[model samples]
Target: MRRTLLALLLALPLAAQAAAPSALKAEDVPSLLKPPAHGVRVLALWSLDCAYCESNLQALLKLQRAHPREIELIAVATDSVAQQDALAQRLHAAGVDALPARAYAEDTPDRINYLLDPDWGGELPRTLIIRADGKRSGISGQLTPDKLATIAP
Candidate 1:
């Protein structure tokens, strides 16, 4: 019984980690963009294979730390379902597994990309800043401190 209990304890964390990222669909983008009433939101889109995604995530983490109360940050992974474990590892390494996150559920990513932004062209490391009043702006590529300030400020 003790060994069984120990196994269960060890498995609990794995289960939680496995469940961390929700399956994101095209229909969910609009609601995800809407922050709580009078609250600012930041949405980060990344892919495991993107060269600049890690740095972009670090910038978002810094922004979140600076404005914990004012900004709500969400991360979305555009990787295939087969890369879920790798995606989780990346999120854990970046210390953002605790934040709200979504992973693409479909194999064809263009559908999700179009739902996110028709003009996006499926770029990696896309960052979107939505203000309390529902205004939004986005940039693709690694974010600079100057640009982060504009988003979180």
Candidate 2:
């Protein structure tokens, strides 16, 4: 009974996730939007230690696949480059259309997050929807395809 209860408890958090965005730094943002960009950018803020970040990444991959022309997804790594390498492999395997990603370090995390989203409230895996005309929307958690589509071009 204890084991079952423990398992349920462990799984509860995952079940409660909503399609939201995590906070990231300014230096990392540019990596998500490299040259030849469409002038429209959707930033996916992910941390190396967050499991939900990885799952959300996969969801982003799926969303991109479902809507190729509508939006451009920038998978920003709010983690380390070492971690992002593995993430890059996963992204490649999943076929997510991502540019070379930039990693963030703890030393500068605060400044960066504050710059990106002043009211971040310390969240991981945040997504920022940037329109060509510079309009923006902030999503704080996991992602749903419909929400993704709506934020997309």
Candidate 2 lDDT at 36 equals 27
TM-score of 1: 0.85
What tens-digit string does per-residue lDDT give for candidate 1 at 75-105? 8998775667778788888777777878888
Instruction: Write model 2 residue lDDT over 70-137, tens digit each, in one string.
Output: 56666766665445446555455444424334456556667666766677765877887777666667
How far residue 40's Cα lies from its native spot in candidate 1, in Å, is 1.7
Candidate 2 C-alpha error for residue 135, in Å: 0.8
Best by TM-score: 1
- Could you give me the TM-score of model 2 versus the true structure? 0.62
TM-score of each: 0.85, 0.62
Best by lDDT: 1
